[model samples]
Target: MTKSDFYRLCGGTFFVLVSNARKPIQSKAECYNGITSGLTEPEALLALAKTVIPDIPKPMNSEMKTLKDNTRDFKACLSNGGGFFRFGDQAVLKSFDVRVRQDYKQPLAAMNDFMDEFLDIKTSTKKDEYLVKGLVELLDADKEIGNDEIFYVRADGSTMTKSQILTASELCVQPFLLGLWHYVLTVVRDNKVGKDTYKDFCPPRGGAERIYTKQLGENSKREIAITYCDIDKTDNDFTEPKEHIPGENEENRAYKENDTSSANEEAASVPGTVINNNPFFLNISGGNNSIYNHVDKVEINHEARRDKGE
Candidate 1:
């Protein structure tokens, strides 16, 4: 559907219901982008998954120098030997690495928007402490999570409680957020940076849990901009070694319609960087020693969600 079609098809507000109440956060509520409505999380996300048209806005000046390669924060993605798209910053690419994988452009834009919108979600909360307690207990019961793990949140307005994240993991189809989380957490655990060392990492309050970058040398002080998106955007303040660290294939698949196997430019392939190649579902933080070349944007298939347990 076109942008207007998306806007016309959506509802006023979106709600997520996982399990029965009594446990706060068992559901979540939010407004859509004033576009599609009443979309079960799946429907909204599927719509959001529409491929982006590759259009790398050109830098005004012709003689600018770029740092896409030398900069630690930027990561470039290539799909199936096609063109490449730079993530993190468009400005950086103009001066340093102006990759022209225009075909895979749509997926990069959509994927970034998808991931950004999913995480760091803003909502109105009702201050349900009881639900928080229950969630803490559930996390406490999780075997894979580390010992220092804890749920941290900050709410100001009216928000619901949880029966969702824990009790109804089955029904709670948080496609966008959970899928992004799966990829990120897998990267974090594999990198071992969030295990600690985060400036916002914390027993310290007021900050959300995050993974920080290690000191690259005796004179660097920026957090590395690491993520699962395919486009490269590094100004390189705190980037890690140039390496791929996922346990499975990381392809940039952006189809024009319901077709996953076909795309305009062979999809986006993030070159240079390789990640873990394992196809295991729920492998979570197991990409520590695994790294493979990712060639396209995330393949938005039904199986991609299943692989991520969305």
Candidate 2:
């Protein structure tokens, strides 16, 4: 009865509502793979909810963070081997409810991967490696490189095609993390981990001390599962369409506001390459302890339905 909402839009664009809808589907096989992995309905919800960073809903003014806003903080940190502290309210929600936790180390590792993704940039759709660091290698007299074709945006004032974006994302690939995802699925197969620990599989939010760190070394392997976020299927009791394609509903795509034509046009004139630096570290401050309010809400709904014999 506590329906999770997925918002989409007109342009072919999307974003995951990690608070309610976490698993955004990126491929067809990943869809079927999610079903066969023995993930129960609640298990799936718990898995998705783990990434639900507690914040109200979002900024009252839907005014988005410009590229400057998005990259400035991270860029500043990146200057001195990215040294600094992040202490601020999460901008997602309306009010500063939960204290934001900042893990400096995690973002540092992710930055290394982020820079790697910029290299060996390939056509996102194709498996071939297209050399992402071409522009960096050019080392023109100009210190900052202009928008290279390898960037996710397009040179023609349009967004990069889906395939192009995929190719560019490879620059983010951390060989240390290579096949780390596939291993997680196998761990779930062996029951080494349950949905509760699923979030740990991806990047640093999973926990402290990155798996790629000296801790993991050669013998370190873990369970990982790829979750698909079907816009309509927040709770699994509902029947899934034969094909669980994303964006089926244009009006309710997850994070649909990601489209940035205005930003793209304005950024074309701007110079300097900005490394992506979204921090996923845990918040030290404690507030509304229960990110699982949705879980309680679901129980209330179930009780109400039973009273009505629904």
Model 2 agreement with the true structure over 1-310: per-residue lDDT tens digits: 1110121110000000111121222355866666443232223322221122221122223423332233222212221111111112233211211211232222223323332222222334221121212111111211222334222222121233323433342333322121111111111112211211222222354455322111111221222221111122122122323543566566454443344444445555644322222223222212223333122011112344456666
Q: 107, model 1: CA deviation in Å?
A: 13
The lDDT values for all models are 0.26, 0.23
Once fitted onto the true fold, the runs of candidate 1 whose alpha carbons sit more than 4 angstroms away are 1-38, 44-137, 148-180, 183-310
lDDT of 2 at 238: 24
- Candidate 1 lands at a TM-score of 0.18
How much is 218 displaced in model 1, in angstroms? 46
- Off-target runs (Cα >4 Å) in candidate 2 are 1-60, 65-105, 108-131, 138-310
Per-residue alpha-carbon lDDT of candidate 1 for residues 1-310, written as tens digits (9 for 90 to 100): 3211111100100111111111222123433334333323332223232222223332223312232221111111111101222222335333221221222232334444543343222223311222222223323333444443321111111112232333322211122222222222221223222222122111234554222221111122222212232344322232233445544333322222335434422443533222322443222222223333543332323444567676
Clashes of each: 65, 24
After TM-score superposition, the amount by which residue 275's alpha carbon in candidate 2 deviates from its true location, in angstroms, is 65
